[model samples]
Target chain A: MRRLYTILSAGAVLGLAGPAVAQNPGDTPAPAAQADPATGSSNRARSSQSPAGGLAAVSGEDAAAAPARADGGTIPPAELKSACERALRDDAEWREALGRQLTGALLASLDQRVDDAEPDQPAKKRKLEPWVEQLSTEIERKIHQRENRAIQRNNNHVIMAYAALWALVLGFVVFMWNRQRALKAEIAQLQLEVEEAAADDE
Target chain B: MKQAMYFVFAGISVLLFFYTIDLIFYGTPLDAGLYFNQKIFYYHVPQAFVLFLAVIVAGVASLLYIKRRDGRYDDVAEAAGEVAVLFGAMMLVSGSIWGKAAWGVWWQWDARLTTSLLLWMLMVGYMLVRKYGGPSADRLAAGLAIFGAVNIPLVYFSVKIWRTLHPEASVVPGLQGSMRTTFWLSVLLFQIVFVLLLIARVGQSRIQRQVREVRERALDAGLLD
Candidate 1:
């Protein structure tokens, strides 16, 4: 009885911890090139993100990517390459400063500890200041938009995973069903043949 | 009555699957960082739960078979082991996709992940032994099943036991709103599917055994000669 209890308990524990799941790897181990992600009071508003913050990060990534147009017009074929490169370098330092600022803000929020003894003190002490909140909005919006692409990609991966699972499961079922049908049919035929032979001998 | 029960179970399973779809799309937005890959949470974690339960069922059934030496116990053990391997493989695949999305790698030898892999391999080995081992295959595989069962706790607790990137074991921690509802509902759906699959597999095993017995009877009656 004790042994049986152990097995069930193991099962319960496994479910509680199954896959050790949900905390995103992106959040913990690999935070991507963006500054560590930080949230503010569960404030999920478009205004929470900064447009310039996103453009700054994207521009960094865009340094390697192609530049389609310069100043709303196409550059001469020969100058296009250098023009795009120049544009990439343009304001890069300032944009980087923005990214850094956002990163610092996130880090700061993380370092702040809420006063547990005074339950209401947390909101007063740890709450984002107005300026910090504004900067956070820009940073968060950029992060959300950028991460949306990642989310879409992960969504695709999830779709693929689900497809693969269903395919394998359905395949197993069909395989078993066919095998069983054939065996039952063959066995029935074999029994009939044996009965016929026995009758003939008698 | 049994067939009606099977149909009822299948219908419920299908209904639950659709219900899960509703929850996934309508569930509240996940916390900032976990939003995207968090979608996998619905399927991946539930599948993991199924894997864990299947392993336990296999282990317990195998243990019973070892003690009683009953063919019925053996059939249940074999059925449960096969389901474990199925769900375990799915768990690994789905998890690798998640790891790639989150960690930027397809595989990580972290404590929870590694131990889960080992447990999966152990379950696979348990099945292979039944399929290929000598006449003592049942007993041999039974012993291996017990081993697989014993290792589940280690796999489940490995994140706690080691320094690992895998998330800690709070299956329901901090989940307050729609996220909580979607999670438990998904789990229930998977459990139903798990039961349906196990019943089908065990019935197949029983049918195969009956066929073999009939063939032996025909041979004994001199009809095969």
Candidate 2:
């Protein structure tokens, strides 16, 4: 009996740990039990009464028939408690079957959670591996395209700016150099004319 | 010796410019925000600074010329005015290109931009007045230079006084790390360029004046008609 208590207690702890088996008032799973082919035992009997009630159901063999009162009324609290105590005293085969059923339910709940976590993507991810690979390749190609465009534009602007700057600086220097040259020529002509006038006067 | 020094300085200025350009493009890390377009700032702001320098020099020289009626002050003022115009053109052109790259527009009529445009136009007017304003051209251009100098403060502070897309004067002060170094180097390069141009211009102006004086004396002495 103590060993049966230990096993039932472990099932209750593990059932609460499961994602689907843990529930609130509105979040309770459907209150039904179907035979599990792998375990050859009935499914979890979730109680609409409360999440604790569902967890209590997981701890006993009476879970399969506990909700079925003869007059179609809800099980009395005291009777439900006595039924749980009776299930603890059930035979070893019945207890082991209950353990197997709980294990299968926990595993199923885990699988459900995993399925919920990722939907349609895993299979598609494998089947569309090449398409996704090609899509990434296209994305990388587009990024490089944009980068090259920016580089070309930058080169044009920087080159133009530098060229314009040099052009202005050089243009001014040339202008000044030309003016100096013209002034020198004019001064030479003036000197020649002055020499001619001086010669004539002499 | 001074002529040789000037040539040496010019050579160094050219070499420094190439070195700074390499540092600006290759050595300096790109601005995280502006990226490629921010490179224009290295030259643009420096040219603007030189433009302001030229304007101030022109204004002060013109003022001195006005007070003393000295031809030397006028010559300096004339050289400064030309340099101001040249640098102003540079500032405007580079600024426009940067604006197009950064702001998606080549021009805007905001306070700083408008005032800068006006300042350039005023300098242009000064140049025009000098070329064609006849005997009184000097006095008129001198007044224009004084006006332009006064407008400099307005241009510098326009971003502060009014909300504008153009960056404030605090940009230089806000720079950090290698950006600050590269920026100042560009400024030095431009200043050297400005001084060389100004010296060349002043020398030419003095010679022109000497030639005119000689021609007048020759005519008066009946050496030549």
Candidate 3:
């Protein structure tokens, strides 16, 4: 439960950290979860209400439904599904963050669907692994593709700027050296002419 | 001393080569939002500082020329003006690239940008007046430089005064952590390079002036070919 709260906090913080902090190009494999500071499983029920992200939003809705069931009433499945979808929409801020959080919600929805169809939680977990793995692989590939393009564009600008600075400095140096050489040659010519005129007079 | 300056300048160039590589690979990561192309900021701002300093040095020398009419002060003013123009061109071009990246436009008529352009043009005008203003060209150009010197404060403060797209002079308040250190270090390197260039330029200008004076003397003594 404490671990769940940490994931929730990371999702919220990732949304708030803005887009720049969200992607670290290629090497950083999702460091967004480090912001979690939750401890103690006693607060398990409250963790769902802790603004963790889309998953917590759905979990909080389930907690709400529990009280409704205790009062001898139940939320219709269709209505509950619509509410969960709306909650996910509001909670997920970044496309990448949404993809990550929705995977959990999707897994839960799949487990619920599998249970309804087969009525076996143990076999259902086995069936879910392949789907989860496939989704994770696809998500990672998309993220790397987008971030690599951004990194490449940024690298181009950096190359252009550095080239320009060195070019300007070297160009100025060459110009000054040529100007100095010309002036020295002119000075030598003037001195030679002055000496010839003096010798002619003598 | 001039020879030592040339060696020191070469050393600084070597340092800049490695420093720029580090900046490319490990400098403060690009601003993720609207300022993604701010890698150029490290280069642009420092160049602007040295450019402004060169302008001020030339302006002061121009004032000295105006006061005593000394040919030495005139030579220094001309040398300083040319150096100022050189760095100023680099700053303006680099700045345009940064602007195009960040602001989505290569040029803007906003307060700070316009005033900066005006200042560059004024420096170029100072050079032109020296080149073609004929007799008493130094005095005329010196007067033009004094006017340009007046515009320096206006150009610097324009963003603050008129609320331009350009950030204010108080960007110091926003800097934090290693970025602040990196910025100041780059500034220090640019100043070292600026001093080296100024020394070399003044020496060359002195030699050119001596050549001109010697040719005038030889012609006066009927030494023409």
Judged by DockQ, which candidate is best? 2
lDDT by residue (A10-56, candidate 2, tens digit) is: 99888867654443333323323222434323333332223334344
Q: What is the fnat of candidate 3?
A: 0.51
Best by TM-score: 2
Best by lDDT: 2
Candidate 1 accuracy as lDDT:
0.72
| Least accurate 10 contiguous residues by lDDT in model 2 chain A | A26-35
Q: Compose the digit string of candidate 2's lDDT tens values, residues B36-73.
A: 77899899999988887888899999999999998888
> Which lDDT tens digits does candidate 3 get at residues A74-179?
7577887677567655664543454554555555655555668755456735465433444565579779788876765676776787688869988998999998
Query: In model 3, what is the error at residue B15, expressed in angstroms?
Result: 2.2
Docking quality class, candidate 3: acceptable
> TM-score of chain B, per candidate?
0.91, 0.94, 0.87
lDDT of 1 by residue, B1-225 (tens): 999999998999888878877778665575576666677777888888888888888889888888887778778888888888888888888888878777889998777787778878888898889889987888999998888788777665765466567776655677777888888888898888888888988888777777767777878977776
Tell me the TM-score of model 1.
Answer: 0.63
Cα deviation in Å at residue A58, candidate 3?
A: 21
- Candidate 1 chain B — worst ten consecutive residues by lDDT sum? B155-164
- Quote the lDDT for B41 in model 2: 89
The A-chain TM-scores of all the candidates are: 0.30, 0.32, 0.34
